[model samples]
Target chain A: MLVHHLYSGGKDSSLAAWILTRLGYEVKLVTVSFGLLDNWRFARETAERLGFEHQVLYLPREVLEKAAEIAIEDGRPNNAIQFIHEKALEALASLPEVGRVSDGTRRDDRVPLLDLSKARSLEDRFGVAYIRPLLGLGYKTIRELTERLFIVEIRESEELEKADYEVELRHIMREKGLDPLEIFPKRHYQSRVLGWREKGI
Target chain B: MLVHHLYSGGKDSSLAAWILTRLGYEVKLVTVSFGLLDNWRFARETAERLGFEHQVLYLPREVLEKAAEIAIEDGRPNNAIQFIHEKALEALASLPEVGRVSDGTRRDDRVPLLDLSKARSLEDRFGVAYIRPLLGLGYKTIRELTERLFIVEIRESEELEKADYEVELRHIMREKGLDPLEIFPKRHYQSRVLGWREKGI
Candidate 1:
């Protein structure tokens, strides 16, 4: 069975990838780049190291806004994070070679707000299975598996900004005692902002 | 400031109590028993050891059901989790001496979902500031603090279940195994259902 583990290059995402691989599932890694994640490269590298084809689905402005709106309120910052998976499900279902999309959804995610069937149904609109492995495990368990596997270089949320994940932090704290840039150091890697200028939200 | 740190003898709640204490706040730990939490004694003991005024909030059936109907999803389990907090918050606010309510709301909790201004507005139509000291800190930091401070006994989420936390594991096998107790285990923990012949659920 092909488990397209949602490989976000974070600890939980990578751990899910590792567990599914050990289970002998055909594992693939997928990342949804908000076009500004601080850990984009780490996510990409980990997926590559895991021997999975890494794909960065650009999160459009509208999608990020919707997801962030929920995340901020839900305290589960990726409240609609699985929407990224939904998009990936849509992308892969169109491809003749791939019939399934999988992810690394966890059990103790405060709430299992994401429904894979939502992705599956959205994909079934195109007739494909959206799959997820390690969905039943907690984040603590995911952390244990990641450490046990000895694959640790992961990204932080701050890595999302292209100019510097510090872009907004700097802008907001220009007059404060601490430089926002110093507080939140910039990430080395970068990604294209497809929707930034036109939408300007 | 009187930080009424909400401690449910749970890690996040207790750690929140400790963090504020370290920052020079006079912390009074509050533990609410909604009745179904089977290990109320253990929680009481932990609170006593920590030397905080541990208070147990009684969850009346009508109030819990009112809160539950609003917070829980119709088909899915565990929606009662948020309402449980709502009930706890109401009880916490009713204390005569409490000026401001503080909590163990950590980086991990959906603080926006539990915003006291929102809860208070809907709840008693009164205002209380709900403060979280470790709002932006990571779980690992909290784990480290829990150990370093000996704030309370470090227990997993299993402690909250009227049944064992592992019950979710078994329940998962029977159900879709999609969510861990569908969020929080739906224990009849002191919901006026357990001791007698009448159907509580």
Candidate 2:
């Protein structure tokens, strides 16, 4: 009955957690932290505002180290971020108490997308249900739903600095003497959940 | 916002309607019928048990007639059913009061599946959000969720006689002097939601 949502402190994952709760699943928001930055704490704050239990899942630096290598070699962040997303999902699915693991990857998502075969492989191997509440939805529809159900703050992805693989991946890239902005795209807007709309939409 | 869910009186659509309601959408369960049979009335009873507003959206017989031609010509029901599913979604999206249209199409569904391009096209042309709540979930996961949430009756597709495109498609096939059993897979099982589990899972 309990589902662990891969929380990024952003509107998408926050909305996913809310949806699970509404579907009668006890949702625990978990942020995977590689210890590159303190962004997970920001996710914790957002989770608190949403009134859900939040926890930080710490992975060894090596998991992200490999992803960084991929990013540097490929001269792009998409594949590296995707690798991290899979690792995060695998880690969540491996938890003893986690029967269902979810994320906010939508239909339009590219960098951190999990394909169906990979998702099914995780489920079959780990004996956990991989639930993606936003997978059926597109970018515009997600924006509409979030606008209806949440009070969100939108800013440039770098300025927002929410808890996600990109934050830590960018840090690793910078540590390796590569400018993240050059490697990753600019003008990317990230949304962080402020709280629910006081008066229902 | 109000969402018109294409209801089949089956567990998938029923669960989709429940999910939409939980996500704070005013859900109207609509059964798209070609009037080949009275199966839509059966869906109405199930919708009543679930306490949602139910309506029957009647399509012109010619639509199913086209689909029937495809099925009989192809010697299979998959493409034919898929054709009907698209038409049903389009009809729901075109309704004056409907700003959001959804279906019970899941990740593993084959016959009635709508690809992302088609879904987006519907959204663009109809000015409605094409929402598929179960799109991220596979058949096994759906079975688990339904077990937790509703009391479902499982039987052969022919015996169940649900208000889905398949039911009407089969009727048309029989009327055209083709045996549906020879066309559709014989071992296929259909589930109908009787009511919610009293004590919960």
TM-score of 2: 0.93
Model 2: runs farther than 4 Å from truth?
A156-160, A199-201, B156-160, B198-201
lDDT of 1 by residue, A1-201 (tens): 564545555555555555444333567666555554445565676555556667665545555455544444454423344454455456655666665555555544533334433543555586555434344333333443445454343334343432211232233334334344444334554332121111110
Off by over 4 Å in 1: A1-201, B36-38, B67-73, B115-125, B151-201
Native contacts kept, each candidate: 0.00, 0.64
Q: What is the DockQ of candidate 1?
A: 0.02
B175: Cα error in model 2, Å: 1.8
lDDT per residue for candidate 1 within B1-201, as digits (tens), equals: 575766656555555665445433577766554444444555466566666666555556455445334433453333445555666666777677765576555434552235423534533443444555444333434454444455332223343332212232234323443444444444442311111121111
DockQ of each: 0.02, 0.67
